[model samples]
Structure formats: structure tokens, C-alpha cells
Target: MENYKIPDNLAVSEEGFLFLPATGESFTLNEIGKIVIGLLKNGSSIEEIIERLTEEFDVDEHTAEKDVNDFLTQLKNFRLVEEI
Candidate 1:
């Protein structure tokens, strides 16, 4: 476990909309990715995050763990998150 930063130029609207820059290319997020980002924005720990997702999404602990780890790895590779 590491912490990550939410991209400053992007945000979620009050209405729960994803806001990306007009000049930036649009990137669609999947269901799990959306939940991960939501928890990350809320300052949840990696372990807490996986726990939350597992409970909220009706996913098994093992599946949630694997998905979150893989998702974080991809986000890091894309520069969407930097270790903190």
C-alpha cells in the first residue's frame, strides 16, 4: 500500500459526473475503476478501499483484491497515479 493523487485538472461534479479537460482526450472508466477513483478521492486506504468495494459491489474479497491491485498498476503506468 501506497497513496495516490487525484488529477488536479479533473474532478467529479456535484451531480456525480466525471469532468475531464476539454483539450484532453476522453477516457472512459469501467464500473470498478469508477468505484476505485471514488474511494481514492475520499482518502481511503488501499485495504479499506478493497473492503469498501467488496461490500458495495457484491464482489468476493479475492476478486476485489486482485482487481484493485491490477487497476492501480495500470493507473500508475499511465501516470494517472503516482506513489505517495
Candidate 2:
């Protein structure tokens, strides 16, 4: 995967929140999203992301799987993330 190419229109707002521009929608992220995005910026792997999230959020594996998939899907749908 091309690690450097984060979606052009995706950015953290002034209040440090993620925003997806294509849909004119805003996402007020919890700490998990913030940390995940930071890791993504540093080219972290999906596996690494899962590990970090699980450690930080105290969520079980199954719940983490579902939430990560759902979040990534939404990002993909809005073109806020690219698979590379």
C-alpha cells in the first residue's frame, strides 16, 4: 500500500476533529479516532492500528473489529481514505 497518500480533502478541523469534505460532513471523533488518524499519518499498518486501538480503548477484539471496519468503510465511501 502507498503509505504517504492520505485523502486530500480529509483534515482535522481547528478544534482537532476530523472532517470529510466530499459530503460536507463533520465527525467529532473520540480519542480512538484521533489516535488512529495520528498513526495513519505515520504510516501505521491496519494490524498495528487494531492493536493500538484495543490497547487504548479497552475494547474486546470482536468489538474492535466491527468498529474499525465500520469506521474505515465510512471513510472509504466518502473518499476520505484511499486503500493505496
For every candidate, C-alpha RMSD to the true structure in Å: 2.7, 3.2
Q: Provide TM-scores for the models.
A: 0.74, 0.70
Q: Write the per-residue lDDT of candidate 1 for residues 34-78, one digit (tens) a residue.
A: 777877887787899889887888889999888888988887765
lDDT of 2 by residue, 1-84 (tens): 223235767877545577766777776766666766777777787777888878877798778867877877766775666786
Question: Candidate 1 — number of clashing residue pairs?
Answer: 0
What residue runs in model 1 are displaced by over 4 Å at the alpha carbon?
A: 12-23
Per TM-score, the best of the predicted structures is 1
Top candidate (lDDT):
1
Q: Lowest lDDT 10-mer window, candidate 1?
A: 14-23
